[model samples]
Target: MIPRSRTVSLLVLGAICLAACSSEEQPVQKLRPLALKEQASNIVKSADGYAVTWAGVLSNANPWHFGEHVVATIVGHDAKGAEVVRMDQPLDAVPPGGSLAFTGQASATQKPAKVTIQYRPAQWRQAARIASAFQRFPTSRVQTMRQKDGAFLITGYVDNPYSVPASTLVVNALLRDKAGKLLGGGSTFVDEVQAGSPPRFILTVSGLPKGAEVAKTEITARTWGSTGRPYEDLALSGAVPVHTIKPTSEPFAVDRNTQIVSEYKQ
Candidate 1:
């Protein structure tokens, strides 16, 4: 028979091994779900067959991490609920606590009555430069014009808040009706957006259904690729103030310190 002292030692060793295995087997933390803020699709008849276009905004719910290289699978369906066309489009990274506006097009021989979209889960990664998370490009002098072909032409100027120059900036515009329903969207690119001098951008939203009235417009600007080298360079440049000062509402010609100025002059 085994001695009592030896038996006790073996039991202790086995207990320690069990605890270590349990710790190693622990599961990793689960990631939060990404939100689909809005999406719109349009199918137009073409000479060859039909043209399919789609635009959407995806939001990263997790405020700390960037969603990298998300893929979207688009499936087109005919009137009888038959699949006609399928496309797999790869998109850029979605910023932390921010949204990604993306657009794509496909050709279909058969007219698709509708289309459905699905997104693969994103691989989360830490920010290359943390300050990039707070960077924003504010737009000014924004205007929307309607084309005769039932499309929208959006014109605007985007200002680079950072000291460094930002090339390849993407401008996105979303069209909405009076009832707040998303009609369609479009995207444009602007280059050489500097700190003091803003660059102009023009985006055209086409392939919209006839008689679709656009009562409101929503516009946003962001770096071409949030996790790419361009974005990381901007982030590493320097820290920018979280807030900017706006011009006061008082009239520019009115001088509030007139009394002090008069006394000093006397």
Candidate 2:
């Protein structure tokens, strides 16, 4: 038999080796932050009062999680460089390798000449591995009608191709002039969409520059699982069913200029 001290030393060495192997198998994860960028095309105007329209892109740079509770602050400055209005808005979740396009508007009595935007990220957690479970079906029969009041009305249909229901179906439309200059944009939201159901959407935009006509129109649609809880909770509660399937296509980026009819030329 070996000496007692030698046996104790060997046991201690074995214990240390076991601990090192355990740590290697289950490594601690470092927190990854979200990245955001404000689009230069964010529109700010002084209508009857101080009207501000803001838009930005939020990207999830994480490798395996979603960014939730993202907040944005919009500060408006008057011609004299005084703060006119400040407002904070919350954006939707951004999944891994995906980005969210967010828009918000605020109105005050003071007119603003310039506007600034800032973003604040709250939490980064593992997202449901089923990003492909939610999808936007093919939009059908898009029609554009120009009203006498210089407002364009775009009507279309959106379908939910997923087997599970989707919440908060948002449709966004961007209007650009012949030179590819963005004129104005608008978005509409739907509360819920049943599986395999096609819902109709109507988006309208007004106040275009005089003699500016829509040369190109870009439309996109997205759907979320639920906004009430966190993504992790949703996944655990079966709110967002996870699947091994992959997304068939990227988000919609359909362009249609044939349906656009303008009364004036730019």
Candidate 3:
């Protein structure tokens, strides 16, 4: 038989142990589903095979959530519903409250009757809201010049307003006709931009449809964290020190008239 005091001490120790075990068990957090808008935009025949282009936007529903290692799979199917080709594309990261534009290509030996796209998120976590905190650089002296070879050249300067260096500056240009119909699109990536400096970028888009003249052009600029390991880039290094680059829109005519259509707030 145990003494009253000893029995009470044993019971107290057991209760403390149980509490400790409960505290160590953290509940799994279920991330919100990612929204994807994708399609097979263009298909062309090549000597070796047929090339298919897939383009779309991937959005994160949670305003305070961010994800990494997101992958997109493109599957081409034949008339009999048989898989012809499969390609996987990797997206580094998705900003909170904003969407990422992706373009992927796949080559098939035979012509595919239909194509399908799917997105998979490797990991999701609650992240600090920083999508709106990016400082947008001012774009100036935009020009669209037609090359001798028929390719279009879109040139512009981007100024970084943040104190730290920004990496992975991506510039996208969409060429449209007089009726606002998209003719073709091109994108270029800049390695890095120093603080308080403007960098000039030249993007060339080839293979425009025959007799397809570009009447209107739209340009957008965006930047992301370093392509290195996670958190290596200053933008994703920390919540307080990181800054985002807001999206900017500039519309211009192929004849050289430029105007600001709209600006996305950071």
- Per-residue C-alpha lDDT of model 2 across residues 1-266, encoded as one tens digit per residue: 99999999999999999999887866668756666643422332454664566556666666566677777888878789999788888777676556667666778687777777787865776656555432334576677777887668988887655544556677777777788765666678765665446788998865455566888766766654323143333234343234668889885564345334342343
- CA displacement after TM-score superposition, residue 76 of candidate 1 (Å): 0.8
- Candidate 3 C-alpha lDDT tens digits along 167-258: 66777667777987656666777666765567888987655655777897667666653122322244444333344676587644443322
The C-alpha local distance difference test score for the whole of candidate 1 amounts to: 0.82
Task: Locate the minimum summed-lDDT window of 10 residues in model 1.
Answer: 125-134
**Which pairs, if any, clash in model 1?**
none
Which model, 1 or 2, shows the larger lDDT?
1
> For all candidates, what are the clash counts?
0, 0, 2
Say which candidate scores most in TM-score: 1
lDDT of model 1 at position 45? 89
lDDT of 1 at 9: 100
Error of 2 at 47 (Å): 7.4
Model 1 bad stretches (over 4 Å) = 1-27, 128-132, 226-229, 239-266
